[model samples]
Target: MPRGNPSPKLAITIDPDVHENILAAAAREGMSVSAWMTAAAREALQRRAGLAAVAQWEKQHGRFTTEEMNEARRSVQAQLRTSRTVRRPA
Candidate 1:
């Protein structure tokens, strides 16, 4: 994929099975493998940032209680169910 500005490139090794899966996923999304990997990396970084923020909050405010965590899990599950039921254009 082309961007107006150039970005650094990365080279890494992975298991053959994982490499094949990445190829298939990239094709399914109509993206180049590099673009797919870049997107995946960005998502991972964002998730790490979110986790770090939560940990910092917990450190100041005390960790979440088990009940609070369970409630959050239930809310997320309900949202996932609702989202799956909604239809989108193919």
Candidate 2:
């Protein structure tokens, strides 16, 4: 992440059905519900930031070029390959 920040507590209630889905997702990730939720929130923020950057870039330089698209594809493929090579600890 980023620089250190003070921890804060948040509490909220969701529909039982949605809660169950969250529980399942947490279990799949081997994390507590709170941890899973925090991770999800972080990911959402990162995606939003990425989208904003892309929007700004597009506004400044028009749409992405074909070369940029191919470069992005290559980067994604490389990341997939690296991730696949990593094994989860038992």
Candidate 3:
């Protein structure tokens, strides 16, 4: 992994089975166990943040209407289609 991270070390305890699982998963991803844990923790935090933001929005404006949801779906699909790169015949 690229550096520039301030490495602060800490120790924690985990079950042997969980430790083995983490080792296997980290190996599969070609990441150190610490890196895999860091990535997973970051993802978990982001997901929680997104959920909190949506909850706050829903409190301000009631949940989205069906039409609004449909529009969002269409917008995302269009974006996905437009964002794909096309290869040309050489």
Candidate 4:
């Protein structure tokens, strides 16, 4: 017999409604539940890390002003629009 993949497996418990939602999301994405959950978990961790980094920066500097926050929001929205336009099929 061939050797199996060496990735570690996790056993998790979620509410029934959440479980059903996860199944539907995985099917919609054409991914196995494990793969979908792994992607979701990775995204969450990345977002958490980004927030922590921002907090550290603010500790050294100061809290962002309303105008600065608005500018950042606009910049992110513009980038998202550009990305969507680029992703569209011809």
Candidate 5:
């Protein structure tokens, strides 16, 4: 998808609990429910793709150097910390 382009419409059904949760989350984020769900779904798909790519790379390469592994760990930890900080209070 191109930057700044509008997203295409999608219709999906969720269980009642899930639907309520999505609405609550969207409200917390000050986003329309559709926008919030779209952003979340996009992030999830990207993360899955990233993990699959990393797995493929590891399978082909066998293993990484100690330094390389440490750098990856640090990068993941930084992302975790940032995500935690940005999360809304429950």
Candidate 6:
């Protein structure tokens, strides 16, 4: 599928109960159903994309061991401690 602007007109079918629940939730949030649904769709798409990217990166780099991860965290902490400073009088 091409990645760009979405179709101006699209149709989706949901169970009536589910649709009613969504409408009620949207009303509670003070958003029109269309806006609420659009936001929900976008968030789901972005989360899926993020998970896919992470999976690809892990496949390429391989997963780190617990020891390796702990060492990396320590190294980062040490670096931050060295680099961070209290603000002095301007």
Return the TM-score for each candidate structure.
0.75, 0.71, 0.63, 0.81, 0.69, 0.60
Give the candidate number with the greatest lDDT. 1
**Candidate lDDT (C-alpha), each:** 0.90, 0.89, 0.84, 0.89, 0.87, 0.83
**1-90: candidate 6 lDDT, tens digit per residue:** 868987575689999999999999888778878888888899899989977986898899998689987997899899878756643221
Stretch of 10 with least lDDT, candidate 6: 81-90
- lDDT for each residue of candidate 5 in 1-86, tens digit (9 for 90 to 100): 57797768887879999999999988888888877887898999999999899899989987778999899899989999998888
Model 3 Cα lDDT, one tens digit per residue, 1-90: 757987877698989999999999888768888988888889899989988998899999999889988998899899878766553221
Q: Which residue pairs in candidate 5 have backbone atoms (N, alpha carbon, C) closer than 3 angstroms, thus clashing? A: none
Order the numbered candidates by TM-score, best leading.
4, 1, 2, 5, 3, 6
Error of 1 at 50 (Å): 1.1
What's the distance in Å from true for residue 66, model 6? 6.2
Q: Which residue segments of model 4 deviate by more than 4 Å?
A: 1-5, 82-90
Give stretches of model 1 more than 4 Å off: 1-4, 79-90
Worst lDDT run of 10 residues, candidate 1, spans 81-90
Residue 56 C-alpha lDDT in model 4: 99
Best by TM-score: 4
Q: Candidate 6 — what's its lDDT?
A: 0.83
Q: Give the TM-score comparing model 1 with the true structure, all chains together.
A: 0.75
User: Which wins on lDDT, candidate 3 or candidate 4?
Assistant: 4
